[model samples]
Target: MTNLIRKLWVPVMTLMAITGMGQMPIFKRYYVADIPGLAWLGEPFTVHWVHYAGAAVLMFMVAVITIRWFADREPLTTSGTLRITLLALLICTGYIRVVKNLPDIHFSPTFTMLIDWTHLLFAMLLGVAALWSARTGRRSYTKQTESLRRI
Candidate 1:
């Protein structure tokens, strides 16, 4: 189960990142809508819904991984600590963005844009961190296997 989750980590993060990018107004107007079949992506609500759904999936995956890590008493390395910090900040910003989107709530345009930009920045950083973690994990696994073969 842990292995499966590890394998899925990168792909899921990539999907979430793409959907998040699609929500950007400029990206939608200049790129997404220009694509023939993907014109539907230009619809703000459609992209928002997809992003929300992806977030739910991501939350679940993170929860499971975190729980398993704690249960197994896994050692947290520096990169692991960084990933956790980024995920926590990302979740907080994402929640704020969703709340600010509600009809009853109104924030200043500047504040809203700040939140959006911060969320996007954290997401991009988190994606890079996840990719780096996966690459390093794979390299270490390969080294372990090679060492075992020689002995």
Candidate 2:
């Protein structure tokens, strides 16, 4: 179960990010409609709902993973710690963005843009870190297997 969740974490976050991007006015205005066969992605309202739904699922998954990791007393490597920190920050920024979007809330345009950009930056960093972690894990695994074969 934990292995499955770990495998899914990156792809699910990537999809959420993509759907979130689809809700951006600039993307909708300049790109979404122009792309053939993908025009439906420009529907802001639907995309917004989908993004929210994905966020909810993401939060749940993170909670479960964190709990399981602690319960199992898994050793946290530096990369694992970094990923957890990034995820925490990402979730914080995401919640702020959601609050800013509430009907009665009124953040300054500059503040809103700052939050949006920060969220995107965190997501990109997290994705790169995940890839790096996977690559390093594979390399170490290969080295271990090679040593075993030599023995």
Q: Candidate 2's C-alpha lDDT?
A: 0.78
Count of clashes, each model: 0, 0
Candidate 2 structure quality by residue, lDDT tens digits, 1-151: 7678768876788779788678776566877566897666788887788889889889888888778766756456677778788888889999999999889999999999999999988888877887898887831211223445698
The candidate maximizing TM-score is 2
lDDT of 1: 0.79
Position 141, candidate 2: lDDT: 13
Q: Residue 48 CA error for candidate 1 (Å)? A: 0.5
| Range of the 10 consecutive residues with the lowest summed lDDT in candidate 2 | 138-147
Q: Considering only N, C-alpha and C atoms within 3 Å, which residue pairs clash in candidate 1?
A: none
| Candidate 1 similarity to native, TM-score | 0.77
